[model samples]
Target: MTTITSAQAYLVDIDVETVRTDAVQAFLKQETVFVSITTSDGLTGVGYSYTIGTGGRSVLQMLRDHLVPRLEGQDSSKIEAIWMDLFASTRATTVGAITSLALAAVDTALWDLKCQRAAAPLWKVAGGFRRDVPLYDTEGGWLHLSQDELVSGAIASRDAGWGGAKLKVGKASHREDLERLLAVREAVGDRFDIMVDANQSMTAAEAIRRAHSFEPVDLFWFEEPLPATDISGHERLARATTIPIAVGESMYSIAQFREYLERGAASIIQVDAARVGGITPWIKVAHLAESFNVAVCPHFLMELHVSLVAAVPNGRYVEHIPQLRSITRNEMAIKDGHALAPDTPGLGIEWDPDAIDDRRVA
Candidate 1:
């Protein structure tokens, strides 16, 4: 029996590669929280979750004060049981970001151990549908960039063999947004896929209007036009436009996703593994999206998500927003414009311990 012996959580702050702006907020830094779990059989697995800028300490505290204690002496092989136990332990904070993020940290570590124990890479262990998932560049598209910059970025991505590039929308006027999308569309040509995101900055009515205006560009998808809680609003927007509504990055529970799917509010699901809890529930959400014939295109944490997106048949494009390079020794493997799932065991993230120590905040 590979019983858990101990769990340790660490917090590290890594600056964003560049200025990352969206309709709602400017990304300050990545406040990454890492959880390392050791088993009785002398094995350790590392798992991590992140906040855009703040809340790392809160997540760390959650693990130290609540989650980690429960991990001691638990069976490392029982991933689902342990996830449920942690969820039940934090019942009061269930279905919230901090709890979910903390749970993800520990839950991922367990999965890392599970994969290592089996001597299989995560993509294969999870359900190897494909080894290489399509890649779409999001780092080049930010609300802060100029129109010229956006166009150049899209062209660069397309020329580099990427499948798509996502542009941040929600400009001051619908005309401004349309102009930007049109500029990128003209530069990238009709064959290259272009996606637009509002970062949940508009109302249902405003989103519908923008969607109609953007129809000429043939966008791949329209993402997060309204706040996550507004399912009815999303439903209205979905019915009002031909563009597919992509959501789930802000959602913290499976129930929220189910409601969106049931009401036909979303076409593409952007469920973030950290926000939704961990790989355990992440896979569940992917399967749930599959049941509805919706595609799973998860948001951020691309290093980890590359394997995840490759794990399931319904998985779509992996959004490229590289934020982990500073603290990690390896870059995600890419070939022919696709993010390849690492064949190495145990989450496939090569953490530089010295670099992590240098950035460690708690």
Candidate 2:
């Protein structure tokens, strides 16, 4: 055992107001959880687990009542083994929701510890394949924004030098979706790379229909049009439309990504390091995508995604959503529409306990 002497989870509150070209919304007002591991040798690492809203409380319960107890006296170096044990321990409890979220937090903390001990950036710990990645502003796609607002966000991202842009689709009707896309095209011009996220809001047939509607503008691809589990459906839709497909945030494991890739399901893979069992599995997915000549563009966790995307030669673009700065004292590194990797130690994040504590629920 590597001798981890202490562990604790904090329920940090997040309240960030995001003002985009479109409508403004408070990205989070709920609690976000962070797990900190301290080694007997005086090493420490911190990692976060978040639920978009109120569900963070349940993840907090799992960490406090269940996961934390298991970490006592274990060596922090055995991150892979620890993650597997926790996943298996919560098998019955986490077919979905809070349990899996808690597992992600602890797993990430262990990786943070490993990288810190090695004195390298995450991409170096994982293996540095690239240093900078093209980025796309993901702000244009939220459901709450108006069409003009969505178009405005797309234009702003383009003006900022982003290589691509993505907007939300599946807005109750194809007519509305077409209108938004057209508005964006007019705002940013027809030649720019544009993408759309259905957010798993459509059926396979609906995805195909909506994709065809934007065929003229040469969209980057349609993201998560159908649910993540429906490989056959995604395959069917791929054959039906010339538009390519993008997926991954909805997927939690490399096994699931392999299933999608093996079937030629998505031309673009969008993995989230925090969501898919931390940096380990996410790196594995990047390698898998490489063998297929596919593009690996990750979803959120932009603070962390910058490193992985920059480390992969075949990486596509990092999703840029600037909502976390209000909660964290430091901003994510982005310039010229590219997200820069952190030169700081660990994951380059220091928890703002006071800022985070301010937003906690009663």
Candidate 3:
């Protein structure tokens, strides 16, 4: 057995190019928690998770003080068993962000090691459903951007042959949101898919009202209109809207996804591997969504998500946001509106150690 001989974790603060705003908050920075593990045989694997701004130190501490020690002497190939042990250890925080994020870093590192051992790429190792998954842009649209900026960005994305682009909703006035949507729709015409995300900022009633207002523009989906935990509210809004309801970024567990899926609260699954405890539970949630005939369009971390999305039959779209560019050597492979999964062995993140070291926080 390949025993894990050593494990280490660190925190790095990544700067955001612009003020990323949704209805609830502005993204201040990205605090990334990176984990690396080495086996007795000398192979090494690295993985990471993130917080939009705060709480990265907590995740790093969890990995170092609690999770890393437990990983010592464990078989690196026993990914599922290791994950379960970690999950059991963090029972009190099983369904929370800090625990899940910590687990994700460790779990992903294990998978990377496992894949490296087998000499296979993660998409093939996971399932190999497709080499390419469709791409959509979330970076182009922010709630704080002016209507002209929004239109120009959408047009640029469309001209570049991206499948679609997302727009942030939840302005003070519903009419303002509608007007922006209309402007973008008129600029891009009916061919381009436009997804609207409110970032879980509305009441169920407000969501339902906004859904109706957005209907005429031919929106691809209305995302996170209400809060993430409001299952009943989501169900009501889902029933009231014709546009597909996309959610799952704020969700931390498969059980929470089950609750949403069972009640028909979400039509599109936006499960985040970093938040859902890495590729292990992320796959469970994806398969669960598949069983329900729902599409999986994961949120953020496009570099890692592209491979996972391409690995699953039900995987739909990969959100385009280049948050890790400075620290990674390769960019996401985008061709003809779709992202091609990396053929390299392991998770495919080419970490620039010097870059990460330069940005290290704690």
Which candidate's lDDT is highest? Answer: 1
Q: What is the TM-score of each candidate against the true structure?
A: 0.99, 0.91, 0.99
Error of 2 at 32 (Å): 1.3
- Model 2, 1-362: lDDT tens digits are 55788898877666545533212223455357888889887888888867655777788888888888899788898888888888888888754657767887887888888888888887667677766778887766676788888878888888988887887776667888788788888889866789987777778877778878889767889888888889999998888888889999878778888988899888999988766767767788999999999999898778888888877888878888765676777877777777787766577675666776676552
List where candidate 2 sits over 4 angstroms from the true fold.
19-30, 360-362
Candidate 1 achieves a global lDDT of 0.94
**Comparing 1 and 2 by lDDT, which wins?**
1
Candidate 1: where are CA atoms >4 Å away?
A: none
Q: Residue pairs in steric clash, candidate 2?
A: 22-149, 141-168
What lDDT does model 2 reach? 0.79
Q: Rank candidates by lDDT, best first.
A: 1, 3, 2
Give all candidates' CA lDDT scores. Answer: 0.94, 0.79, 0.93
- Tell me the tens digit of each residue's lDDT in model 1 across 109-139: 9999999998989999999998999999998
Q: Which candidate is the best by TM-score?
A: 1
Q: After best superposition, candidate 1 residue 181: deviation in angstroms?
A: 0.6
- lDDT for 104 in candidate 1 is 96
Show model 3 residue runs off by greater than 4 Å: none
